[model samples]
Target chain A: MHEYSLVEALIGRVEAEARRRQALAVHGLSIRVGELAGVDPELLRTAYETFRAGTVCERAELRLTTRAAAWVCPSCDAPIERGAPLRCPACEVPARLVEGSDALILDAIDLEVP
Target chain B: MCTTCGCGDTELVPVELHEKILAGNDRTARHNREHFLEAGVLAVNLMGSPGAGKTAVLEATARAAASKGWRLGAVSADLATDHDAVRLERAGIPSRAITTGQACHLDAELVHRALHDLPWRQTDVFFIENVGNLVCPAIYDLGQAANVVVLSVTEGEDKPLKYPVMFKAAELVLISKADLVPHLDVDVAAIEDALARVMPRPERIVVSARTGEGLDRWVAWLERRRLELGLVGRIAGLAGHVHPPGARGDRPAG
Candidate 1:
């Protein structure tokens, strides 16, 4: 799965950051993913564990912030709930998807500089 | 071995490596995109569930391109066998099969390799027919000019709602197997309604590959795109310069 590859990148970025900060141990890593990002959290977590086995982040925790697929109708101005092909409910217009979904951001990391 | 400060032991020291897992592929994908731009070739990545009639649509479309004299080639991704490639080759277009072993989708690296291995210097348009899966392929980039997501009426109308990412990412949507509209219980309107919600308004084409239904519009659409991409001009420049003699010949080379 592509999650494995994504996890590898995350690990590499964190490792680099850790090295720059002179951190001896990383406590955790945080990522924000949206509902519509089309990624499976379970699979990603599984891949993360396997990938972290020999890395410094082996003992670090992963924090994920999930956002929902919410939208505001460009025509009706009504807030659309998270649904397949998100649409506006009130005016029957194609709603403009706002921001809870389709996110793949590496927000921050927690580490102890020794 | 561990007698002296345990230094002789295979120390399992864990190095903290925090990273996004998709970073590697994303880097490759970006490289692949740049490559397509440099080559001046448009790549269209096709994705959909199995039985969505991807092959049939590709076959009909390639056949229609014959009279137009457009240089078209295809790389069909599957887990095994070159059946789809053979089918496309029979239509007088150069095509190849990409077996992904047990992988579910076509990744950028595979496509990058395929481009180098194919007769890229001759062809103007290339299509990467991804393995028949909706979930995995959407996440991988194939250095495509456009991404097409094909849906059939036989599948549930809630498909778009169920798989929002695929619908949203697609530049075009083609509803296949439309000839069975009368027999099936599909709510075409509902599907469109769902698509409107999740994605920007995408060009929607309804066609039945079996009966040659709605081929003119589809072909015209392709022609319009070809014109937009300057396909004729690009191929003309390469006709005598790059294309292999056999490929440039009037007869089908393969």
Candidate 2:
């Protein structure tokens, strides 16, 4: 899965951060995945587990949070819920996606420092 | 000695680093985009499933564009072979093949490397035909001006619904193999309906590369896109700007 490649990128970033902070090891990582980001959280965790060996995140706990896709009404600026009609509830006009489509963020990291 | 933790002399710190996981790739993609824009090259990322005629469509397009005196270049990615690149070269276009050892999708970094290998200045329109899988490629940004997803009629009409991410990410969708429609049980209308349901007002084109059925229309669309990207003047000296086929405005057939 593409999750493996993403995990690899995540590890690279974690390693760089850890090195910059003079941290000995990473204990945990918190990530936010958006629903429309096209990533599987379970697969990402599995990939992390498989690839973290001998790295800074060897024993790091991978915590993933998901964000739902959001759409905004162009006519009235109302937030439209996912799976709802594309039309805005307030203005009865087609809605536009404003945010929540991407969430590949590493919110925080727990590390063991000197 | 740490006051907060009982463990002897070991400090456990929680660092607040709000960084994106794919930031590296995104940064590279942005760089690639800048490179293309600076060169005035219209880079298009062509994506489709294996056997979806991605290469065939590119080959046909290259041939037609060459005939019109427009210089085209291509980069094809696959697990192990250079066959697609060879085919494009045979069609008289400068092409390179990025042999991804085990990568499923072509990332921006790989594409950036491939872009350097090509004589991009001489090329007006550049196409990056990504690996055949539809799932992984949807998430990757190849720094292309447009993402064109091709689906053959032989594939099920529900493919768009089945792979919503790919369909949703597509800037344009091409339903290939229109010539085979008379022989197959495929319903092109159903495919269009499925795409419309998943995609937000998708611009779809139906073409048959084998019989040159919609090649003119496809080229015309490419020419229009080139003009929109402000690349017409750059290539005008080489190609003299042929009139775009009138069929370019033909809507996706129901």
Report the C-alpha lDDT of model 1 over A25-112, residue by residue, as the tens digit. 7888878788777788888889888899889888899888788777787977777664534555556666676664677777777776
- Highest DockQ against the true fold, candidate: 2
lDDT of 2 by residue, B40-78 (tens): 678999999999999999878876666677778899999
Off by over 4 Å in 2: A70-72, A77-95, B1-8, B235-254
Q: What value does DockQ give for candidate 2?
A: 0.55
Identify the candidate with maximal lDDT.
2
Q: What are the Cα lDDT values of the candidates? A: 0.75, 0.83
lDDT of 1 by residue, B193-239 (tens): 87775576656888889888877777787667656764445434444
Candidate 2 residue-wise lDDT, A1-114, digit = tens: 999999999999999999998987889999998877878888988998999998888899998898877777787887776544456666766557666565678989998987
